[model samples]
Target: MHDHGSLPALGWSEFLTTWSLQPGWLLAVVILGAGYLTLRNAAGPASTVKGWRVASFLTGLGLMYVVVASAINGYAMALAWMHMVLHLTLIMVVPALLVLGHPLTVIAETGPRAERAMRSLPVTILVHPATGTLLYSLVIIGTHLSGFMDSMAQSTPLMVGEQVAYVVSGFLFLTGTIGEEKVRPDLPYLGRIALLVVGMVPDTIVGIVMLQTERDLYPVYSGARPEWALDAVRDIQTAGGLMWAGGDGGMMLLAIGLVIAVVSSPERRTKMTGRFLDGVRSARLAEESARGTTEGPAEPGSVDPDSDEALDAYNAMLARMNQQH
Candidate 1:
């Protein structure tokens, strides 16, 4: 462990050395690099894979280094607020970037065997939305429990486990909700928006409770104070603020991206229009049924151009008529 005295002036050498000692960071770098190289080498003339996907994957790996192998991790062990930042990065930023890279899709495209493996029953169940959501919620709630947090702080292995859990849960949540990977049927843009909105509730509640609490929830930080001079109570409060503001801020950004995606997609626009027309037709049918009356068909060659429903129903009819003529 780096000395607490030099934390205020920690240098790059110390940061690199400390991070290199951790097996997790080394393992992550190897896996990420290997995956990217494999994908690149496997690409053929017909491959549609682009450069941005590789960049995104590398960016995720960099984020992992920052969270676990940098000076930030050193400070996190001694400060509640820093730990919260680490947690937020692991559970939100890193996973979002990885999912956006479409790693699973890339792997599947590599070969038939890989595609088959991705579609196996166990993989299917693991990537389901319900499973992802439940696992994510469990990790968020479980790690925050008083006993668990303190115990994690005391044991290196447990702390590493907690970090791993955050990454896995975050990946699962995004994969199940908004990722391009075909785990189950893809969620429509509206469904993605709704899932993200509802997911914010638990994080918001946890943050608010942390902020309101009078006592320090994690005692491990009390003993090893950072050189920058943050008290335990203040540290806890700062952590709460990070979780509240940072977590929500990340979610809001993702929501904005989803909105952009929806608006830009021609297919989604067409689907929405069809759904709107179907809904209108269904309501009209139900109203007619309730009134115990049936409307006569329109005159074969006429359209009520002034009526909104008539216009909607016949808008494409004009195009067909023009083509026929």
Candidate 2:
């Protein structure tokens, strides 16, 4: 057997070279540090710290794995195709699992006002139906049909832009799609299902690209396939097809779990739904309040006729769940 130690050290840009201070690795360290802080913060003396610890650790691993491929292959070598693959894991796979580690609920407990704001504004913009639909379509088409994927491995600047787009879009999709309670007041199980179905469109395209492409489009990496004598176009197409078919298929399965969550998670699910409704209430209230539609500040003790009893009940239910939990 060849002595593994005899292998000469490779430079940073040289494929399969010794590990070095590459940008992707540096990016990974930052991600790991952030997740570490997230877990560490959530683990404060009393709570079930195991969840955050595990979540943060896994998130770190997921990020590192994505970056590792880039680091070894050379950042900007192929305009960033590797980074796209990395993002597939970062935004889609990792966040879905990491949220279960408990940092999200801890974030919920950050008090009503702050939590409200964080989940509002920028967060709300993304969580909305229009934005989710837009993002899902873009993730599907932007990454594939638009020819953006090929350059991500070639240019660092474009790669950064791609990453920025992917992270923002993915995170928004996840939070709005997953732990939407803090942002939205009331989301039904079916509604979430609809959104996830939208999200899967991108993956479906990815798979189709792989399955349908007649010839390899990216010759660089596919040409370098380690052992497999795979055709470049066919290989790229297969990757897209796998992304389309398997990725979305996996997302659908995850959606099933989310359905269970909406059905079973009383504290988390109800409050989230209620809060979204509360936002609707607040918006309407602002509208009415602005137009002075109520005639006058009602006589002290006078009940307003427009007050919604269901809203009151929903609010009460949410309060009780919070206190009880």
Candidate 3:
């Protein structure tokens, strides 16, 4: 085990030496890369899978590997702060990148059968905004409970399961909110902003509670003492602080990005304008109908017969009637 206090001086060579292989992570990367390539090729002459999207997907895969198989993973088992870093990257950073890459869209575009699967009712519900938000919140809150955290840290299999939960929850949260792909219950720009803001509340509460707690929550780290004389309590506090700040900061950035995307997209702007106009028209029609009910409609041809305006109107009406006939 490495000393926590010596974390700063842990050179790249030393970090590389400590790197571990996670077969699951490796397999995921291979599958993701192959899927992207296959989707691109299968998309016919005009591929929707852009170069940047491929890069983004690969980058997400790299981040997952770093959190699971790099030296960071080894240190995370020993240090509370490192563990927090790993969790944040897995849940916040990696998910955002992967969602932006539009993985579901790529899969759907793979073939007719894949498209049908993507459109299934179960998949639709899984990606619904409400379902995703609830599941994400449950995973975050449930896993962070003192007993659960301690149990997970003690068992390697449990830790792996916890990591999987984090990735899945994070992916679900972002799949319908941030990405360009259209999922079930597609939210408007304002709705997406509201969803993000609401989601931040639980994360903020968890962070604050962890930071304020006096006693250590996870006892698994007591045996993994650092040679550099690290203070476990202080490290735990730091981890809580990171969780609080990182979670809120990441969500805020995503919200801003969503706002920018809405503003920049001509199609979105047009749809918003159309909705606004429809609303205005509806309100005006309602007002006119109410007025008509309260009073009464004007008698047909009620204009003054002697006035030039009435004569012009009559002539125009006659022209229109003749043309229709």
Candidate 4:
């Protein structure tokens, strides 16, 4: 039964006018924006922060508010697809933009003590690419697969928690993968690509489950949906389709961007090639060790395999192999 008092059908005009104040979210955005601005200004004229990065951070903060306080949030209860949009934006788009802004780098710029803290052990572990990737995958799979979404509908705090989880997981994942955050070592381009690819598995699984399931998975949404809303089954299917395509598509674009970065930058290209050669070198060394060769291990503080001399040696070895072949 449609509640006549429920929100009117979500036409374009209604969407434009249908925003809620969502005081809590709005306040959070204000505080974060103000804090970022204060920090940026305090970083002083000598600080090397770029204007675009500052803008990106502020834009992400603004988008966080818009996502939770806008008509999309209002319609999410009725529209599974809208919820997925919210989910993806929180986990992927917003976090990526925020990472690009390099907020942690900004914080580190304040002082040597802050820089030291940012690069401390605990912080390093927290932002490690592997850690972030695992957390992102778990959060993606767990929330959608478990009873959390259904429970979220009945509890305001759960709903907020869900939103928070999405943003935090995304931020952590992207911080490790994308930005020059002082908290962690820079992940290799190949490592970043792998992390993103692994992250897509949960998205694909959740999307497929939602899309293909004939059973109505989310009763709360089905029950609460206004008459104008899509039927329960269709809503989920739509949401699933969005999740599958949007999730994979967004990640693919990011992967392509990473590939482009590697291709365009001499340093990145050399690093990538060197990493591959290093793996091969390690395998050969292990083999020789197993065979009881007299060769010793590399010394401490060895030159990076990505160096020009290393590249020339690797290429020469490859050319020799080709000639032998």
Candidate 5:
């Protein structure tokens, strides 16, 4: 095990000042940040992409740097709760911000070839919401529930690998569910909301298991824990609680964001209303066609196909559903 014998007790001042200069991670961030800006600028006046996307993307990159290359990394190795904080930030908050950036949409705008490639079979499958959810579930459950944590603490490469996996899995999941990439099929807002809500289940499960487990789950922490670190059991419980709160809380916030986006977008609301009206019209036409085919002709007493009664009833049903009447 790497030495934590000389590690200082975590405090606000130290947390603020202590940072690991991981040149490799920093270089990656700089490159990605530069690339995103270049693409955003390249899209130019023709693009409708907003300014906030650029900000969100950069902010996400910054947070990723802090999580992996800051004092958090040091504390995380010796403290379970700190690790949970690092994990949740990497997997949840950072990914959500990046998704909001719409990087894929920006890339697709480069040319027809790029757009087509984005919509290619392999890319489509990789970004599918189901695939993302499955990978996310596996990562969360595998890393926390199994012996991966024990191994990760001792192996630098494994630690880096785990961090990379968290970001990738999260990015894939969010990119599929909440992303509005122009090259991909638009996921209905309601469907996006549902996916986010369901995704919280794995976090809840892992958190509860960690919080309630009777025995120490990760011996590695106990062995490497600094003098000031919480005892293993208490530390794990705290970590569990943090995971449960952070995971569900982050998902809920994102769901609410989707709800706000739907409510705020007049085009989306209009589209939904058009769909409802179209469904009603289709049903009416089918009913008329069926009556004509079966009875051969309409009787004098038959309801008029153009009558407003059906539309009125539908409106009333909607009002009732909304508790408006």
Candidate 6:
């Protein structure tokens, strides 16, 4: 007969077990988290285009990433490279991209009595550079420590702690990436640049260590492999490689994206589209004043660049104000 409980260790405690499924708590968290987020959104004023996009991503992608993966793998995924890959993708990629979509702010600030909570100190602190950096580092190092991952995988409590770590770390990292209100305006550009670089340090170290190792570090996996696949050492090393090579690359991408975002602000972008309009306005104003064309058509429909208006009204006003006189 097959020995079900007699399997060998697949390095369950070596951390980086992206295959570790978190079914029960993860499901409850998703259901409740989504509901809470939805209620918060409802408390805000009117919904916005951005808000809709955020909601769509969270409901469609986020829920799937959390529920399905957690349900399938639980804590037994340390041995599965494929599942690890999925876990990392879900933890970092989804969170970062979803944050880039800016769903929370869209739902919170643009909706009705939009909660000021998002802008509150507690929220801001959660997304601050310090917080993101700490969360990212600890979630990686603390969880992966041989003792922690092994011990935790063995019990329900530690397993749940793992869940909390991943979720909170992910949330913080993404929020830091996408938030402007949580901006570290006081931080010099170079400082922000260095912060990101520093954040990648642990991941780089972990990946390098894994790649260099010849054997599996985690003794937690109690299962055997197909032999053609990775042995313990190779798997552990590959986990490192995945972090350093892949994670470092991700950090670089985020840096590039940030630079692009800064340079591509609407105000900065407006130079291209608004330049001709402004120049034409200046020329016409000079011409009309010289010609005494009755104080320039009263400019009654002129839309203030600083004011908010319906798209229709704004477009209509802009068209009228730029009339030849």
TM-score attained by model 5: 0.86
TM-score of each: 0.79, 0.60, 0.79, 0.86, 0.86, 0.62
lDDT of 1 by residue, 56-104 (tens): 8778877887778776777777777778889999998898888877777
lDDT of each: 0.72, 0.55, 0.74, 0.81, 0.82, 0.56
lDDT score of model 5? 0.82
TM-score of candidate 2 versus the correct structure, residues matched by position: 0.60
Query: Which tens-of-lDDT digit does each residue in 1-325 have in candidate 4?
Result: 2222287988999888878899998888898888878877888986677999999998998899898888878787778888899999999999998888888888888888988988899988888887788889998888887877778877788888989999999999988767766556666777788888988898999999999988888876467778888888898999999999999999999889889888998867655534556577645534433333365544422535545645655666677689999
Tens-place lDDT per residue, model 2, 30-93, is 7755765564565475444355555564664556455545443332232224334555665566
Tens-digit lDDT string for candidate 3 (163-222) = 888888999998867866743445666777888997898778778877886777765654
Model 3 root-mean-square deviation:
9.9
User: Between prediction 1 and prediction 5, which has the larger lDDT?
Assistant: 5
Give the Cα-based TM-score of candidate 1 against the true structure: 0.79
**Candidate 3, poorest ten consecutive residues by summed lDDT:** 297-306
> In every candidate, how many clashes are there?
0, 30, 0, 0, 0, 28
Model 4 clash pairs are none
Q: Which ranges in model 5 have alpha carbons more than 4 Å from their true place?
A: 270-313, 316-325
The candidate that wins on lDDT is 5
